[model samples]
Target: MGMRNHELVPLQLIAVIASLKHGGCHKVLRELVRYKLVAYDATARRKSSNNEGYRLTNLGYDYLALKALSSRDAIYSVGNQIGVGKESDVYIVANENDEQMILKLHRLGRTCFRQLKNKREYLNHRQAS
Candidate 1:
């Protein structure tokens, strides 16, 4: 629930980290997996680890990070969009003390993903021609 690691975490380790009941944690994990927030690998040795477990997907990480930021008074309510760029979304957000702040969601990774998709399609068409 806290630490963010690329390595797969065993269920037992997760229970220990979150200090939650095993049964409840299992149910919650199932829900998260269903929502595509968590990715579960049944096969071990994928990451050269003997234990198979779950890890947060990119979406899950983003959700957790935003939640943490909100809890820490980094952002309060979101207002209208102030500006945006090709790889980011800028919005006016407020802090706990009602101070306005500019929150930018930098989606630079998505830009690369989009470019890859476009290039792949273009290549396929070129091959046909």
Candidate 2:
């Protein structure tokens, strides 16, 4: 996703980009807002139309950056976004070796938990065998 300085993203757009259903997106956004991790502007306007939108708070940005840094592989730099889906975004990144790699960041939530759980179980079972 392109960085917009203090940009507010609509709920619908967030749902589409995060690959989340409306209900799930609402739930997650509510929680984030409650925690002060995301800022919500219900009176925000664009093109003279009022709309509700969300933006990451400083805390949110810092949390994401820390998470990325804690990955197993040392990341040199995060480059452009390559793809986006309902639940994640794929980005081009440089590793410690300076080799380009694709980084997929998942935006899992209540709606996607079951799917991820099943996949994890399957992988674990396969590995055990």
Candidate 3:
């Protein structure tokens, strides 16, 4: 999911959440639900068996705001969008610590485990060569 400084729709926000490392999206959702950080959204439907829909609770919005701030720091203050790999866009970002880091924004729109594995192989080949 790509980051945008402005507000994001639920699906786009979900995409951003899903892009994080670890089971962060699920963890966040579970915690949010437990903490009542979410509200039922009548508009969004759960089309896919794997994904369910909910609106952010007040706390959820705060969390998303923080994420947006972080993403803005990464994109604006640091290096701009540099390159697009097969599955992700690579950006060079400087954190508050002033350390340069690579932000790999996954293209969740086209993400699949099978395709990811194949792309990993390609990356490995390039690195090895």
lDDT by residue for model 3 over 16-128, one digit each (tens)?
Answer: 65675445666766677788867544442226534335655445654564489587664334477899876666777777777887766656325475543444432333332
Point out where model 1 deviates above 4 Å. 1-6, 44-51, 78-100, 105-129
**Cα RMSDs, all models:** 8.7, 15.2, 13.4
23-46 per-residue lDDT for model 2 (tens digits)? 999999899999998998777444
Error of 1 at 112 (Å): 9.8
- The window of 10 residues in a row where model 2 has the poorest summed lDDT is 120-129
TM-score for each prediction?
Answer: 0.57, 0.50, 0.31
How would you encode candidate 1's per-residue C-alpha lDDT over 39-117 as one tens digit per residue?
Answer: 8976665366565788777668657767988988788788898886877777888988899888777653455764544
Shift in Å, residue 52, candidate 3: 15
- Model 1 lowest lDDT segment of ten: 120-129
Candidate 1 — what's its lDDT?
0.71
lDDT against the true structure, each candidate: 0.71, 0.70, 0.54
Instruction: Identify the leading candidate in terms of lDDT.
Output: 1
Better of 1 and 3 by TM-score: 1
Cα lDDT of candidate 2 equals: 0.70
